[model samples]
Target: MPWINDAFWQQLAIGIAGGLLGIIGALLAAQLSSRGKPKKELSYDLRIERALPEIGKELAPHVAIRYKDRPVPALYVVTCKVENTGNTVVKGQQIRFDLTPAHPVLETYFAPKPEPEWEIEELPETEETPGPNYRFGHLAPGRKITIKIILAAPEEPKVEVRDFNPTEHVPVLPRTSTARANVQVRARIAVALLLALLVIPQAFYALGSVGDIAAPVVQLGLVAALAPFAPSLIRALVHLLFRPAPRINLDRGIVMYDGEIRGVINFSGEPADVPDSAQTLE
Candidate 1:
């Protein structure tokens, strides 16, 4: 009967409620801060997806695709993709693709359409400027426009961006298809909300509204609930900050991190182990 007293039940409730409320509070705080400052990462990629001459290699110069009764020689089908790979929305960005050396471009098509109020202008080649500039405006976060071009030139188009600053220089990985990120974003928000609801009582008590005796019990209960997640959180921070970065040494033709080589290698005419003294790129 002593264990079943009103005080005992009260403590139990307070402890459980407090732990939950604390977790909620912490998650909410983190979510707010994670919104982060304004950042812009404009990533541009140019790839020749296909190159079919249609004619023999000796007569390849005559390969052509007709556009409205006009014969346009087809050398390659190049895809130019521009993506806003940053968190904050970037506006008024000027992206220019220059096709130099007087190449013949038959068509420029915008795949998947584009975001609203976007414009693409054609800058004709002048006596002063040799290349034709295709200028685009206003692309938002996670939105990308892929321009597919039917061309009659061997050289790739040069890309230039203006009126925006890149947050960082992150090298774009080569992929046959675009990789989608930040999936199911709503799930994270939902978890944060659920955690906040659990710690409401502790929040009120800590705000100086609850009794002296109940305060410590509630606080401890909340701390106990959140304790299990501490290790994983710490581990994540550690891995993010101190993780080793591996690089491929082209000269030695090996993959290594901090002078330590990883995995096996197959060099056609070279030896199994490259001399460490042969070259050191640190």
Candidate 2:
């Protein structure tokens, strides 16, 4: 009964007020730090050139051209040249490149392909012309591979190359679509970590002042609830901010040119006038 005196009640009230204030302070710090220091925007330079019209016939054998596995209104070819430009005996290094078309075209070309296991549905006609085939394997350091991609004109075509370093799952440069997503996700993670640092100490302090175990339990519960969602929240934000491109699935078959010079090719078949021209894009 003596321990339940007015002094004891006053102390308990003070502790509760302190705990609430501590939580608010911690949350504010987290939010401010999470905003992060402003940074200068990075600029990436990319260049695409149209393949020169003429090349020596002898060079044609070295240059390989193939239709993209998809159909298109215009005729396009992708050419690659690999050379060991370095004097060192380069080995074990592989070269990979991905070309993403510009906005409307990319959206159209990358329309998601149907899932095969799902209910059968008629496939949509491919609206993309053939381009050079993609290659994966090691290339020497001094070696350079030039890919020539030709497509039937829909105004002008732009291509971007994403390079993968030997040691990473993701490439160094962000593709136009994924860059903003990554930035938002990183910010969310930073915020979550900062919050954890601030909340944990205050939580321990509250637990010590009052032998009440519930204080610590509630603090831990808040952390647990917020931790897993940080990543998902960032992803959702990206989805809301920028709509991703549609997926396109391509089937094997030649979209033969029927000599008409101006029409869509749907069936798979060999391309007419398979050029033996020696034109290197390197």
Candidate 3:
């Protein structure tokens, strides 16, 4: 039988240390590679143009007034501007507007012009909310387009905008072009080396100590062998419990094809005559 000598224990300690060191080095490389990767950002600029009176039937939807105007009574031309402010170009974008009238005073009092350009599809009469779905073409970086909607109302209507659609699993970002492939290769190598350190040394120790050590010692050796894998096991458990979810920034805007929104529009009008302010005829 082989002697359980001091050199045996020394080699075992060195093997455990080497395995731990390999694990640490692998983790550090993975973190560094992730940090060096470029970040991808999706952002846009959305602006609501002011209401302007139409010049005539020929230019029914066009508004000459570019400045913001107060919500008032009458037919007002409303324009919305959507701009791509990020590095990537946006394609096949669809935006939805939801309009809600203020109660008995304003309900059923709103009317919008019928035009295909406005893309305002009226939902069933039973539906309480009113608005339109507008389709926008591809927008290059730093590019913008204006959408016009003609609305007639006695008071301001509420409007809301919803653009973000959330999904699972965020896409992995790529490292810099020059180092991408090299980094990936190094990452795989590190992982493989770490696994070898964990498995090879444990096997050698178990085989060497066999028959020489008692049953309790063998159990202890098994525990020691598995201890090196605890970190990875814990990480796997954590990842299983809490997987990453995609983030959608509605206010910041998204690059998707379809979106929904709501807002309020007040029509320009004169308030009802108040007894206090009413002047009696002389």
Candidate 4:
């Protein structure tokens, strides 16, 4: 019988062993290849100068100031330096800076400015006279740029330079106390949609296999997905449909607080405060 042939059985056993060895060798080779590949390290530094006050209402083309000593009220100038140490060219957008009060006491007591004003200027004319306000648009590999900030301390106040940005600065949104609620509603809607997609498919499959009624399951799933998203979607639709252009009140000043002293501060131009809806998500 075929099953009783020793030579055939020996050949089968050898084939199986060879296949197993081949698989094991392939796995080892893959592991070795992965291990031999070196991870790339990023080589670029984009530091933003501390946000400082502009001299006046007249838009100054360059330079900004941040207060270092609030009690003595001394001005501190933070210079931002961007260096492209990597091998590739780096491109960036406008540079934005903000000075926020450090502590809760300062938030209540001191008068601080809202989001810092933005100065969009052309890039520096020469390497020697690199402009401070203007963003470095492109930096060739191994190139570096610097920006200077001049700080003016409040009268006999304690000041500290807290934060700066060029990379992924916090988004300044239109401020409304109800903004947080809107964000929460949006998030809930998104979650409900995801759940509907997952659960409805499983329910439909089960019902189909059992030959049971599936119409109710499908309807309920659709409703569940639509319920939470409906309100926000409707609001958006109305805004789009009516074309009632939203007005931005540029006159209002956003309040900022000092870290060392507790007080409300004012910025020159109207800066939108964080939306309340966003705060709720946090």
Candidate 5:
């Protein structure tokens, strides 16, 4: 039998630490879909449906935008998706959307064409709130509503939820960059491959007739060898397939075009990660 050097033991220790972190990541992902009754929360996601430059160089060539014969700036469409992520039903009085900058709303409608009963009222700006607020009706558990707003503002407006005794708001966040994701995938493959190299032969030795170790020790060794390898392989697939896409920071503002997010600019004009390729839209 070949024994590993102390250096190998140190490397194994690092792998063990990494395995623990992978377990933690799995647990946090599970919480996103949890419908625990004890919690009171609303989850929201924003997507830019349409964005075009009103004063871009390309539009300067005899192109005019008018609605009903009246000139208008290039309209920006944004969809705000609010979901009742808790087990308890949420009433109309408990939730509202607080929008910023008091942007002029040209058209407000629901996607998929809603029923007559589905209605929301926009409250006028108040002394306390700098912008307008949209009040919604009752929302049942696991129910969601997607409201599309056509804004006259040059960019998408930031939205905030209020007045609900809500504990938290879950927003979609950016995922790993392409370069980072490739590195992670390769690392996972290497770990799983190396673990298989050790596990398969040990498993064969435990089951084969030439095995000299006691049955109980062999069984324990098999369990120890298989535990780390399974999760490492499974996490590789999860990271590859279900990794969240890079999303706009709704608190600042979203700038998207042709179903692709160009950049998310904040009040300070500082932008977050903007992709240099077609993947930037994601």
Candidate 6:
């Protein structure tokens, strides 16, 4: 009865109530932040080139001809066209093209075949994606341009359009949804820690009681105080262990409109005519 005195029970009850209030406060704060207006918005209009032969808008790969004795694996004149559809001008923009071949023979054929008006830069090769990155400094609204790259492979090559500065046209997210997401992540961590705090010591007490190492009255008081939060503790454990994966849907047509193009090799062949051409875009 000494361990179950009035002061002991009173303190335990206050601790449990304070923890519950803390959880409720964190949840309310998260909900309010989500409903608040976003702090910054990124909006810009750009489109990649696609086939419209009638209007002369296309992303076509033309095969170069080989005369009788001329041996060529396969040579394609890969053309990428990008246009500005938004009202604002895009400045200091660079387009990154990624080339990955299913066949190793095609690796030797990828090179920047730039047009006179365009400037090109060759990016250092990486193990995962080895190709050149072409820079287009500025694009005026409604202005379109074509970038031609020479690809010599045994099969049809694939190209990708990326590295445009669309954010240059819209406000950057200094703080807003990003802050909210960070706060939410902290809340989850807090909840997990609180549950572990509540459960682990009580579990030790239970084991102690079974082994005759704990006084009965003290154990009873702790159990009564913690019983109400058992369901919440279980839920916290489940969420911590089994969170869902984030989903992303990328549509090349929508993401790279205004002349960004991505290409992949669809055909296969030997490395016989693979061109040893690797040049930096100037």
Candidate 1: which pairs clash? 19-222, 20-198, 20-199, 21-198, 21-199, 22-199, 24-195, 24-196
lDDT of 2 by residue, 1-282 (tens): 668888777767766665455456555655554445532121123344433444357985565433345533344343434343322333333333344553222212212332333221222323342222222343433334343435544334555443323443322232343356445655575466546655565655656655243355446544654565467566656666785443322223233222224445363556344333412111
TM for every model, in the order presented, reads: 0.50, 0.29, 0.28, 0.23, 0.42, 0.29
* Prediction 4 global C-alpha lDDT: 0.39
RMSD of each: 9.7, 20.6, 20.6, 19.3, 14.9, 20.2
Against the reference, the lDDT scores of all candidates come to 0.54, 0.43, 0.43, 0.39, 0.52, 0.45
Q: Which ten residues in a row have the lowest lDDT in candidate 6?
A: 48-57
What is candidate 2's CA lDDT for residue 30? 57
Top candidate on TM-score is 1
Better of 1 and 2 by lDDT: 1
Better of 1 and 5 by TM-score: 1
Clashes of 4: 27
Candidate 6 lDDT over residue span 138-196, tens digit each: 55555555555555455565655456455453332223333444445445545544554
Residue-level lDDT tens digits of model 1 in 108-192: 7778676457665545756654443444455567777787777765455443332222443332322222232222233344444
Q: How accurate is candidate 3 locally (lDDT)?
A: 0.43
**Model 6 — TM-score against the truth?**
0.29
Q: Rank the models by TM-score, top first.
A: 1, 5, 6, 2, 3, 4
Q: Which stretches in model 2 have alpha-carbon errors above 4 Å? A: 1-9, 40-156, 160-203, 206-225, 228-282
Considering lDDT, which of the candidate structures 3 and 4 is the better prediction for this target?
3
Model 2, residue 86: C-alpha shift (Å): 39
